[model samples]
Target: MVVASRMLFRFSIVWFVAVVSCFSQDSSQTYEVYVSKNLIGTLIEAKIISKDVNSSKKILYHAFKEIERIDSLLAWQIPTSEISKINSYAGKSPVKISYETYSILERSLTYSESSNGIFDVTIGPLTQLWGFNGDEEPTTVPDKKAIDSCLKLVGYKDLILNSNDTSAFLRRAGMSIDLGGIGKGYAIDRASDVLKRNGLTSFLFNAGGDVLVSGYKAEDQNWTVGIKDPRKEDKLLGSVELTDKSIATSGDYERYFEVDGKRYHHIIDPFTGYPASNSVSVSVIAESAERADALATTVFITQGITGWQGTSDEEFLIVTNDLKNIFSPGFKKKYHFKSIK
Candidate 1:
């Protein structure tokens, strides 16, 4: 429950974020490219374009290495991972964790409390009950009794964080944290920092479609991104131009299963232990990919634009299953979305 509560607090604008075709990179020779052996069950590709081609190759290697390092530390599947250790000691005692893990959990708890439990990190119990704890094919419908029992162990309130001691404790045993939702975005953010510090300026870091662009893709053109169409296979609902920003999306169509005319997806609702059905998908644009990722899931769980309006400081677009499009007034004002109809 400790790690689970921490996971869902960040927006997982998963699957809604996609890349569009750009001009062919004839200048590919002037870039540093890196693809890592480390896999987080999520795709991570980062590109750094450089005026000085010689330096970029080494930069790319380290950039990808940095992402792999973060993935190793955060992935819950790894038995020796810190999150795994936390779950192992659940309800037993506080286990001292790294400063980075402690920091993430602290912010996670704050978001959980502030979101009124809508965005919870301790949702592991429910996620497991629903069979969302694994990366295999979408799971079958769990019995309602199983869900209720798991719900008893779920809540962000149960994840206790001690800043002074740099540790965390789960109020109950049998609870685990899954960072699958927000960890990708967090990894992207950290990798981006690594790039910036190494003196690379213009590039795109796409970690499993959660995209963050820095500066213009070209002299006068910003990076172009697209949001997937929930109803259509392999088609984009619309595209947006971005520079120095991060955009993420969460949709019902991403990962799910259907049986007897009913559908179940991975975005397990922390409260109901079911897939959130309020919106077909939600896209969030924020200054940080981490925030955008977190907002995408939180807003979808909020159900619609109206529910998200009063609290969110970021711009968003919510597409509900009914085909109604909801855009924040701020989004409508600052950005021009193409004719999506």
Candidate 2:
């Protein structure tokens, strides 16, 4: 009777431990990472859902590290970054780079081609001249001679890429490339890849206003993303829902300064050497954050109402400076915009 009672006590303890483990597995985990301070620079926060506690932590940790790595590698401010090296060698010889950097640069060149230079990567000189690149601030608008000189260096065609993704070269000196418009989205996409490889079943990765959601938040519910009003800094224009997709928003309100009552934001028109004026804000949704990010910037610069009508592959919402919204067809079909007004 004593032996049988002892066996029953051990069995109850085992069952209790199993129950506690199950409860822990069903819970959620969250992490926050701060990388920089621009509208392009942002703090990232993510919520990961998984059953394995060890794997969840590992995935989240690695994802944040991946973003930091990308930031350092792509930042033009960092003198030792691969991009900085490339810019340093402009008008000279080809600068060899890692396959990762080569891949992104190659993709950027393609976008620069397709967008007809609206999304030129070689606009760094223009950005710097306007005091928008890195941490520089100018008290007034740049001179016409300076703007014209930078425009000479702002052509995407000047950036030459190699076939093997090993190296790239700039056609002339004084030309530089800026990846701030697309780097955040590329980093977010890579972070998502890390999470998937670590076996996360569900997640929401947000870097400031740029966000990517994987799987459902609940059994059947989607993730809700808030859209800020273009005119009002503290108000929300509406909200959109997403699942297994990414959304990237670029707005004039996110970064800029007023010069004699005229606002100058970061999204510069390569042709005019000035901040784009057609769209006050542009939010894009696509299968990947990289695409969404690139399109969001491209649309703002392109200044078209339909937003690249050649491609129905993604959805977009472009808000003009007057607060008028022009949405892509997919938005009307797939989303129900909730107005906060």
Candidate 3:
């Protein structure tokens, strides 16, 4: 879980969309910006191009409300959340959950299975063990025995969902689930739905590093989003022009603690119960923010682009731990990325 203060730092190293022009030369085509600092443990920013100011403000309000609802339901840190109930009832009995929570869990399980447990939501135990659960940061590396113990409780296969009762059960007593890897993307998608339903065609919605854009930023120009270089604070690897698409980036810089010149990030491997070291950063572009978020984490945990076997609809840019940049053929062809260094 990213805290509000750390989320600010996370945004600096993660990707950022180019700011939409507030005032268009044609006064009739200006955009309204909406920003919220207290939602989803990170910044929520949206720019909508609308003619009716009242309607757009109302729509933005509802969009944020939708995100808040999700955070209340799925946030593991919240004791009243459904996720907490499921964790509390682990190995005891099934805990009834809302449809939204159940659906996201089901979606998470799909990614877990497809990624061969590389993207497991059952990594909650490992997260807590390493002190990366936003409660505290680890001063020293955890013992191997402790990591192994946590690994025992970290398997997506042990999570069971019952559609008939709309319930979830964790087979092990200490097993837990954290939706941090994919929840923001789901929320962003839901918010995007709200804007589209209100008949807004052009918008840019970003929560943390999860971004979804629609229509155009201007008359004929697509939105340009910068992909920050994970190695540098104020540098970008490049930018991509996108419309009607979603992009997400996961990097080692988001949350981490250093000990003896080594950095251990929050993106832990469920199998090893330690930070995944194959990739320094990974950015994924997909049709939906949900998929992009999951894929970004999945590739980072696996072997970056070399190990990825994604579908036709997906493209990726991976910065390996060796400081090498790997771009999927489709990504290179479609984005036409130029060197920014």
| Candidate number with greatest TM-score | 3
lDDT of each model, Cα atoms only? 0.76, 0.82, 0.87
How much does candidate 3 score in TM-score?
Answer: 0.89
Give a tens-digit lDDT track for model 3, residues 18-66. 2333333444756655555568788888888777767788888999999
lDDT of 2 at 200: 72
Question: What's the best-to-worst order under TM-score?
Answer: 3, 2, 1
Candidate 3 overall Cα lDDT vs. reference? 0.87
Off by over 4 Å in 1: 1-38, 133-135, 306-313
Output the worst ten-in-a-row residue range by lDDT, candidate 3.
17-26
Best by lDDT: 3
The TM-score values for the models, in the order shown, are 0.86, 0.87, 0.89
- Work out how many backbone clashes candidate 3 has: 0
Candidate 3 residue pairs in clash (backbone atoms < 3 Å): none
Residue-wise C-alpha lDDT for candidate 2, range 1-341, written one tens digit per residue: 99999999999999999999887644454332223323326778787655565667666778888888998889888888999999999999999888888899888987777777777889999988888655656567789999999999888888988867588898899999899878888888899899888777578888877898898776687888888888988998888888888888888986788988999888889999988988899888888888888888989877655346335657888898788888888775675667788
User: In model 1, what is the error at residue 204, expressed in angstroms?
Assistant: 0.7
CA RMSD per model (angstroms)? 15.4, 4.3, 14.0
Could you tell me the TM-score of candidate 1? Answer: 0.86
Model 2 pairs in collision: none
